[model samples]
Target: MHTHGTETPVNAPSAEIPMTAHKTQAPTTDRSAELFEQAREVLAGGVSRNTLLRAPHPIYAERASGCRIVDVDGVERIDFANNMAALIHGHSHPAVTAAVTAQLEHGTAYTMATRAEIDYALQLRRRAPGFEKMRFMNSGTEAVMAAMKASRAYTGRHKIAKVEGTYHGGYDYAEVSQAPAPHNWGPAERPASVPLAKGTPESVLQEVVVLPYNDPEAAVAVLNEHRGEIACVVLDLMPHRLGLIPAKDAYVVALRDWTREDGALLVLDEVITFRTEVGGMQTRYGVSPDLTAMGKVIGGGLPVGALAGRAEVMEVFSAGAGGPRLPQSGTFSANPLTITAGAAAMKLYDAEAVARMNRLGTLARARIEEAIAVAGAPASVTGAGSMFRIHMKAEAPTDYRSSYPSAEEKALLSHFVDGLYDHGVMAIHTGAGALSTPMDEAVIDQLADAVLASLRKL
Candidate 1:
């Protein structure tokens, strides 16, 4: 089922992929299978969302603790998945718990106002200089949705340009190239926006224009081509769909300059990657964006997201602006508990702490790449600092087109991932995942050995 537009799978063999091994001893997840069967009778596809659905049966997780998940089947496994890279402190961090506990007694949500909300925003400002003003939201999806809307209002333009292969909360305008077939995504240079899931309205597609991620020339051409009509160019600071292809520094600088010169705003989705540094990767790259959509670790481990940007651009959210005010309302926006808990988490992530995490992440990636080489596998690792991905390809993918799985390759990866699972390294089936602070040399060595053994089977 591999096609021209599809990316190579992270774990898929390069060519003539072998058939999957036959069932051995009926596999071990009878209990999970029974639960999945029961869920299908009530829940759609035995799960709430597409991301949760996996091969055989989705594990019914009981509890998780720092880097480990105990599924209902009594299987204790390392959680490299980290709830899709949201749990930066791993599971149930004590500091986060203590902070959230006091705020819980105060309140969860109050449509009126609260002091905790201001503290959260102020703390974010302290961490990120670019965040002169910020507005809280419920999830990364909500933050990005608002970001797109805010961009349109601020720039008086309706169209949005997004990088191919980046996943930005699956909002209609941004999900065009996320893990989709080339047929649906259109051409290479001049891409057509195809809806990812069915519920997306055609109207959403009308405003989105897809751009090649690292191709600076194509980016300028697309920007110039779409010029006056493009509201904003939204991008993930770190590409998350395939390998963690961190956008090149110069490429990002080019986009910022081009967009500024063109009067169109630039939006950076730092949702999954904000915790890596005090100011996110934007500070590291010395590139500033018009607006930033943030989530993941911002609320500790709780569900939270925020839209941050320059005070000038965010002035529209003031009490009384000129035109119709774009309503930024969420039932749990800036709730006391999340705000308090998030502040604690961010404060705990000092420069030294950040450095330590980055060191571990860097070491882990190097070790894994070494393991791949030893196994005689064509592979590369990508990402920045403490956040990286194992790209089972000859080289790190410069763009999304080079990164992910083809249908046949995905079929091949089911076997590969099964071997990985059997070896004790848990990750998402999408062939992408990240590292966390809880992992040390021991954990890294275990993962390296696990990957090496899995490759031997291939």
Candidate 2:
């Protein structure tokens, strides 16, 4: 858990504080509560996404600027969620806003492709040289689905392997075994394909092979056993639920080697991790995948997704190809507004901007670690670049099973999240945070102070 800075001794006596002692009354959100109740009549659970459900009621955002968001109740807080790490430049940057506004004047969609789409695609290809060709989609979920299908088409195999407990998207095969209970998860070396949803068909579950995170030998063994049937090995370099636990270099190399030898496509889901570098996180590891599915920051606060890869493999999507073509089309795919906004966002997030944010992230993690030592809390921080998560344990977790918090730990984390919210700082309830280009050292300091105050309250 120690960084390059001076280590703070964890010698303070453990606080004997009850969870209820720190549980203050919820924030004033009459407008939000009313809106939730009204929307529940039409919207299932009063929220579009299940993750939006929070205790008391979800805060309805009125507007946002830079790294701050104002709720319908008029409460302003420093935003770290950043729309689940998509708004790299934060809300309404002048460049992205102007681009989208100009595009709106032109038109929204059309039957033919616009020059904006071509320009945006070229911009991305230059940034990440691995993407020889790419196709835009409506979301990360759709991009993942397209990648799975392309892999099957290229390899002529039906099965896919993914790390257990890692989230790819809502798609059934990609989401299989995402959050399986301990009883259903089976052995670490040979993990079982447990369905995330109740109605997930048995046939869908059988097509996925689960692998243990960071366990190279075990992963290799499982892949070897299913060599012929596995079409691809899908992975997120930094999985969200595992506190952004980085994939080990050796483990990544092993997957690359195995997939190459077995003729299985290697799909890297960089939807969230793309913010880690201007060239994307893949460059850092020096391991390239056959297919890369990206979203989040690429859309610049807009809804968008992309699937890119070598020209040969991506040819499956081209109708002119001699063999069978994967038909891919969407009403809003590569709309001018999103393309313009995404290009502007990427332009603003150059290598210098990324390096600055990564430095801030390092400082933030160090400060949080110092606070944990001072509070004598059994916790550790895990993440790389601008993304981080505080785990409710003394040691940093390398796998999903170790990262899963106990009931008491979850309660403490909930209280911590609440305290941060009340202190004018916003973080994910799951203890994760994403830094944006709008955030500076001062914001990082403020976040560290908020964490200290929250820990003291607990």
Local error of candidate 1 at residue 346 (angstroms): 1.4
| Model 1 stretches astray by more than 4 angstroms | 1-29, 321-324
**Model 2 misplaced regions, further than 4 Å:** 1-29, 321-324
What lDDT score belongs to each candidate, Candidate 1 first?
A: 0.75, 0.86
Compared with the true structure, model 2 gives a TM-score of: 0.93
lDDT of 2 by residue, 1-458 (tens): 22343322121112311211221245464799899989899998888988777888787997777777877777778889899888887778777887899889989888889888898899999977789999998899999999999999888899999999999999999889888777789997888999989899999998999998898999999888897899999989999975689999999999999999999999999999999988788999988899999999999889999999999999998777464568879999998878888998898888888887888789888888988888887889999999889887899988998888888988888889888887778898789999887777677777887887888888
CA displacement after TM-score superposition, residue 23 of candidate 1 (Å)? 20
Judged by lDDT, which candidate is best? 2
In angstroms, how far off is 270's CA in candidate 1?
0.4
Model 2's alpha-carbon lDDT is 0.86
